[model samples]
Target: MRVQALIFDVFGTCVDWRRSVAREVAKVLPQVDALAFATAWRAEYDPAMARIRGGERGYVALDDLHRENLQRVAAEFSVSAPERLAHAWERLDPWPDVVAGLTALKARHVIAPCSNGSIALMTRLAKHAALPWDCILGAEIAQDYKPKPQVYLASCAALRLATDQVMMVAAHNDDLFAARYAGLKTAFVARPTEHGPHQTTDLGPESDWDVIASDFHDLATQLTP
Candidate 1:
């Protein structure tokens, strides 16, 4: 397969959102269950995006959605300072192999993030995590979220490349499923620890992805120039 670019699914794929957000939660809500709070807050993400994707609401930046969700969960957890806590997402740390792996992958293919995050959120996260990306792509570009064909196609359009020439690299089977439907090449990088030690799903590849890698470094090695 001829591939010229590799677009990543940031959140859990590159940065360990679960742990990073949990760490932040512990700082602000010491008496709360940090991991559980993080999980509850994130659980609100998809349903919130579905509102926009289904046309119930217009496009809202991921950061704003995050803040909204933070407030909702903060109330449930009886936590204060929801605004400051929401900003924690901007400072997520990348998985150990991400920076080095993407650096190597960038040697051959243009690298970017095709995430649901807004450009500002993606940029801050990239800088905080030290990810080497050529550009940011995803929902903000399409004004829609993943699983929506427009999101994937829009990113490909932004790069002026055919969908088939750009591979969607992600850890979730559902994400790969959507990208494959959009006519993009697909690669799955197993991130068993993405959701934490108890992650029951996405522990391994669920389909015949073009490449099934154990980590980003392995993916960089598998991609042909």
Candidate 2:
């Protein structure tokens, strides 16, 4: 089936969150290990969302989760000014190939983010990173997070497309696994440095996804005209 839309996983795949967040952290907590701080903060993301997914907590925007997680991680490191640091997620930088690739891909298909990030967060980050997104979709719209059937189905419904007509692109194997289960075609764009130098997960495509590309630029070559 032809892929009419490509819904991206933004945080790590479209943007270099680790390095960018670490850099931002360095500015605020000059004494802390910026890279480790960034890693620690991200480590809490899934667990935070899991609470909501499991019905232990209610749905909240990524910003709220990030802010709450920042406070906890900051206390762990005894870092001051956690409030300022929480905004780092908004200022993340895009991967080098992202702009060109998204532009190329957008010419051929509708391109949007199906990330866990909120619409406001995604909008600000997109502006900060100069990302070209057609629309923002995902947790905010679904009132639920990814790896859940509702999130993927909500995105497909919003775009007025069938599940098979859309492709979910991500660097995370787990995310793609769920998307595939939701009946969306999957694309794995390897983001080896997403978690920094020693990252082990998502080093390559973990399963036989519908498409696997080295990066968004390569994805453009394979999926875009």
Candidate 3:
């Protein structure tokens, strides 16, 4: 199927989550253990989402999740943080190629972030990074996270496009697999450093994804100009 729109995964895909978090943490607590704090904060992400998904906890937006994780990390490390620190997630710096690559893709297709991030968080991140998305679509709209077929289908439905007409671009293999199962074309862009030096999975494409690229710029090159 010809792709009419490209749906992107924001964190760790378009932006370097580890680096961004580390930088923000360092800025707030220069003498603190930034890397450890970043790692600890990210470690809480999946478990928090799982709780919500498993019906063990109420629905919480990505911002809330980040805040909760940040609080825990700060307490664990004996670091003091201001209330405004949670907004740092929205101020992440994008990968060097994100702007140019997204601009190239936007010239031919509708591009947006279909991520687990909330709309407000994604919006601020896009603006901060100057990510030229036509729109921002998030799990907040679907009330679920990636690896769920419903989130992928919901994005297609919101764009008023068929599943095959849309493509999911992500750094994670599981996310691409979920999109493929939802009947959408898939692109895998490797972000091997996403987990910092402890990276253990997703070193390359794990399935028969439609296309696998070194990064977003490479993915844009593979698609028709």
Model 1 TM: 0.97
Candidate 2: stretches off by over 4 Å = none
What is the per-residue lDDT of model 1 for residues 165-209, given as tens digits with 9 covering 90 to 100?
999999999999999999999999888887778889988888899
Poorest 10 consecutive residues of model 3 by lDDT?
51-60
Error of 1 at 94 (Å): 0.8
lDDT of 3 by residue, 101-145 (tens): 999999999999999999999999988999998988859888887
C-alpha TM-score for every candidate: 0.97, 0.97, 0.96
Between candidates 2 and 3, the one scoring higher on TM-score is 2
In the predicted model 3, the residue pairs found to clash are none
